[model samples]
Target chain A: MTTDTYQAVQASNINKRSTRWAEFLIQSGLGLCALVSIITTIAIIIILGKEGFSFFQHVSPAEFFLGTRWVPLLEPQSFGVLPLVWGTLLVTFGAAVIAIPIGLASAIYLSEYASDRVRSIVKPILELLAGIPTVVYGFFALTFITPLLKGIFPDIQVFNALSGAIVVGIMVLPMIATLSDNALSAVPQTLRQGAYALGATSYEVTTQVVVPAGLSGVMASFLLAISRAIGETMAVTLAAGATPNISLTFFESIQTMTAYIVQISLGDAPAGGIAYQTLFVVAGLLFVITLILNVLSQKILMRYQEVYD
Target chain B: MSTPNKPAFQLDYGDLKRRHRKAKIFANFCATITWMGVALLAVLLAQVSIDGFKWLDWQFISSFPSRFPAKAGIASALVGTLWLISLIAIISIPIGVATALYLEEFNSKNRLNRLIELNISNLAGVPSIVYGIIGLAVFVRQLGLERSLLSGALTMSLLILPIIIIASREAIKTVPMSIRHAAFALGATRWQTTWAHVLPAASPGILTGVILALSRAIGETAPLIMIGGLTYVAFFPEGPMDSFTALPIQIFNWVARPQQEFHELAAGAIIVLLAVLLLMNAAAIVIRHKAEKKFK
Candidate 1:
C-alpha cells in the first residue's frame, strides 16, 4: 500500500481509538459521580456507626434508647436519647402543625383556584422562602418571630420551641406547597370534569376527588417537609435553645438532635470523647430517619406513576 | 374504591343550597390564605429592605467588618463569595453535565447503572450539613486540604451535584432522539453528533440548570459553616487553599452577634444575597424563554 493510504488508515484508527476512550471516560465519569454519592452515604454510615457503637460501649444501648435523661458532657455522662428525641418530636410536630394546614390550603387554592398569572407570581415567591438560608431564618425566628410569639404568650420561654417550630414550618412551607401543587396539577383534568359532571361543586370535587387522587404526592410532600424539619440545625440551634430537655410543651425550651450536633461541634467537643460520639450517633439516627422517609417518597412516586402520568 | 353509581338526579334543593354555602366559604377561605402566602413573602421582603437599605452604600459594599457598623463593608466577603462560586461552578458543571450526558445517552439498562441512578436521586435529599461532615472528613482531614475555599467548594459541589445532574439529565432527555438518528445516518460518529449537534441544542437547558444550582449554592450556609468557612476575612481569597468568607457565613456570624447594628448588617448581607439569587433565577428564566423561542 502507498504511504498516503497508510496515513489515512492510521488517522481513521486513531480517531476510532479516541472515540472509544471518550465514551469510556464519559460513562465512567457518570458512574464515578454516582459512586461519590453512594460513598458519601456509606462513609457517613460507617463513621457514625463506629463512633455510635463506641458511644454505646460506654453507655448501654438500653439507656441510650430508653433513658429519659441526656447530660453526657457534664460531671456525669448520662446518655439518654429520650430528651433529644422528645425535643425533636416537639419541634417537628409544631412545625408540621403549622406547615400542613397553611401549605396545603395554599397549594389547594393555587392548583385549583388561582389563575396562571397568580401561579407565576406566587410559586417563585414561595421558592424565595425556600431559598432563604436556614441561618437567616434562624435570625428571623430569633429576632422577629420569637418576640412576636412572646407578645401573644407571656409565659413562653425566650428561647422556646414554638418560634423554631413556627420558623421551620414557614421554612418548609414552600416545599410542601410546591410539591402538593405539582401533585394536584398531575391529577387529570378529566377526573375533575367527571366529578363536576356529576354535579359536584369545585370545592367538593377538589376535597373529595382530587385530594384523594393526589394523596400519595401529598403524603410524599409531607414526609419531605418533616424530614427537612427534622434535619434542620442552624435554625433550631439559634431559636430552639440548645437545652435537650424532656418537655412536650410548645412554649418550653428544647433542643433537637441536629441542634445538639451543631452545639457540640461549635463547642470544644474533643475527638474520641463521649460528647463527640453523641454527635455521630444522633447524626446516624437522623440520617436513617430522613433516608427512610426519602425511600418511602420514591416508592410512592413509582407506585403512583400510572395514576399521575 | 367504588365510583358513585348515581349522580344526584334531582339536585336536592335544601341540601344543595346548604352545601353550596359551605363550599363557597371554604373555597374563599383557601383563596384568602393563598393570598396570605404571597403576602408573607412581601412582608419578609419589605422587612429586609427597610432594615438593610440604609447600610447598602458603595463604601459599605467595599469595607470589611469593624466594631462600628459604619466602617464595616462586605467587599472581602463579596469577592470571596464570587471566587467560591466560580470555583464551584467550574469544577462541578463539566462533571455534572458529563454525568448527565452519560446517563441520558450512553448508559444501558444494567444493574450497576440503575444503582448509580438510584443513588443520585437519593443523594438529592441528603441534608446539606451532612455533606459538610463528609467534606470535613474526606476532603479536609483525609485529603489534608485544610479549611479552605477548595474544600468548601468541593463540599458544596457534592451538595448540589445531584441537583445539577438531575437537571442536566432532564435537559438532555428533552433533546429529540431523531436528531441523533439523523446525525448518525449522515455518517457522524456518536461523539461528533453529541458534541456538535446534541450539546448545542441542549446548551440553554443545561445552562439554566447550572444557573439554578449556583443560585442554591450562593444561599447555602450550613455546609460552608461545617467546613469551617471563615466568617470574617479582612482580605479577599488569593487561592483555593486560602481561608475565605462568603455571604451566608458572614451573615450567620453577624446575626449571631448580640449587637442590634450587626443584625442590620446581617439583613444587609441578606439583601445582597437575595439580589444575587434573584439575578441568577432571572437569568435562568430568560434562558428557558429563549430556549422555548428557539425551539419554536
Candidate 2:
C-alpha cells in the first residue's frame, strides 16, 4: 500500500475511536440520570426501613399497626397507627365522594355533549384549578369551606375533617375530570353508534355503552385520585386540625398519617428521638400503600388496554 | 298508499325533524351543565386573578412581610422559587433524559429492564406528599440538610422524576427507529447513533416534558411544607443551607391570616405564581409545536 493511503487509514482509525468514546459519554450521561432516580428510591426505602426497624424493635409492630390509640408525644407513648389511618381513610373517602359524581358528570358533558367551543375554553380552566397549590386549597378549606360547613352544622369544629375533605375533593376533581374525559374520548365511535342504532336514548348510550367500555380507565383514574387524596398533607395539616381522633363524622377534626408526619417533623423532636422515628415508620407505611395503589392502577390500565394507541 | 292518510305537517320530514329538535333541546340543556362546570372553573381563575392581582403592587413585589399585609413583597419568595426550580431542572433533566435514552435505545426488553420500566411508571403515580415524607425522613432528618432549599429541591426532584422520565421516554420513542438502524448500518456504535442521531431528533420532545414537570414542581407546596420551608423568610436565602420560602408558601401564609387585607396579599402572590406557571407552560407548548412541525 502507498504511504499516503496508510496514513489516511491510521487517521480514520483514530477518528472512529474518538467517535466511539464520545458516544459512550453521551449514553452514560443519559443512563446515569435514570440510575440516580432509582438509587434515590432505594435510598429512601433503606433509610426509612432502618429507622422503622429500630422503632419497631423498641415498640412492637403489632402495637404500631393495630393499636387503637395514637399518642406518640406522651410519656411511655402509644404508637398506634389506627387513628391516623382512620382519619386518612375518612378524608380520602369524603374527597372521593365529592370528586366522583361532579367530575364524572362534567366529563360526560364535555366528551358527549359539549360543543367544541365550550371544550376549548373549559379544559384549560379545570387544569389551572389542578395546578393551583395545595396550600391554597388549605387556605380555601380553612377560611371558606369550614365557615360554610359551620353555618349548616353549627356544632362542627372550626377546623374539621369535612373542610379538608371538601377542599381535597375540589383539588382532585380536575384530575378525575381530565382522566375520565380522556377515557370517555377513547371509547370507540362504533360502540356509541351501535347503541344509538338500537334506538337507545343518548343517556342510555352514555350510561350503558361509553361508561362500561371506559370502566378500567375510569377506575384507574379514581385509584390515582384516591392515592393523591390519601397522601395529601399540607391541606390536612392546616385545615383538618392536629388531633388524632378516630371518627367517621366529617364534622370532627382528625389527623391523617401524613399530617402526623408533618406535625412531628414541624415540632422540635430531637434529631434521633423516637418521635422523629415515628415519622419515618409512618412514612414507610404511607409509601407502601401509595406504591401499591399506583402499581395496581398501572396494572388495571395495562389489562384493559383502554389507553388508545 | 297502504298506510292510512296522515296530516300535512306530519307528511313533511322537516316538521317531524323540528319536533324531535325541540326534544333535543332538553339534551342541549344537559349540555349546558357541562359548560356550567366549565363556568365554575372559570370562576376559580377569575377569583384568583382578580383577588391575586389586587395585591400586586411594587411593595408587594419588592419588600418582605410586616404586621400589615400591605407591607409584604414577594422578593425572597420569588428568588427562592427561581433558585429551587433552576436547581431542580439542572439536577433532574440530565438524569431523566439519560434514563429515557437508555430505556428507549440501549436496553433490550429483558425482564430486568422491563421491571425498571414498570417501576418508573409506578413511581410516577406515587403521590407528591409521599415524596415529601420521603424527603423529610431521608434528606432533611437523615442527611442533616434541615429545611434548606437543597433538600426541598431534591424532594421536588424525586416528586417529579417519574413524570420527567415518562415524558422523555415518549419523546425518545417518537424518534423513528429507522434513524437508529440507519446510523448503525453506517458503522455507528450504539452510543454514536443515540448521541448524534437520536438525541438531537428527540431534544424538543424531551425539553417540552422537562418544562411541564418543572412547571408542576414550581407550583407544589405540600412536599415543601413538610420538608421545613418557613412561611416567613424576611431575608433571601444566601446559601443552600439557609431556610427559604417559596411563592406558594408565601401565598398560603397570607391567605391563612384572619385579616382581610392578607387575602389581597394572597391574591397578589397567586398572580405572580400563576404568571410564572403559565409562562413555563406556554413555552413548553410552543417548543412542542415546533417539534411537531420539524418531525412531521
Best by DockQ: 1
By summed lDDT, the worst window of 10 consecutive residues in model 1 chain B runs over: B6-15
Which pairs clash inside model 2?
A: A30-B98, A33-B95, B52-B267, B52-B268, B60-B73, B63-B73
- Please estimate how well model 2 matches the true structure, expressed as its whole-model Cα lDDT: 0.80
True interface contacts reproduced, per candidate? 0.41, 0.47
Stretches > 4 Å off in candidate 2: A1-15, A306-309, B1-33, B49-52, B141-146
Best by lDDT: 1
Instruction: After superposing candidate 1 on the true structure, give the runs of residues whose Cα lies further than 4 Å from its correct spot.
Output: A1-18, A304-309, B1-14
Candidate 1 TM-score, true structure as reference? 0.93
Predictions in order: lDDT:
0.83, 0.80
- lDDT for residue B187 in candidate 2, whole number 0-100: 54
State the lDDT of candidate 2 residue by residue for B268-295, as single tens digits: 7877887888888889979988988887
Instruction: Determine which window of 10 residues in candidate 2 chain B has minimal summed lDDT.
Output: B7-16
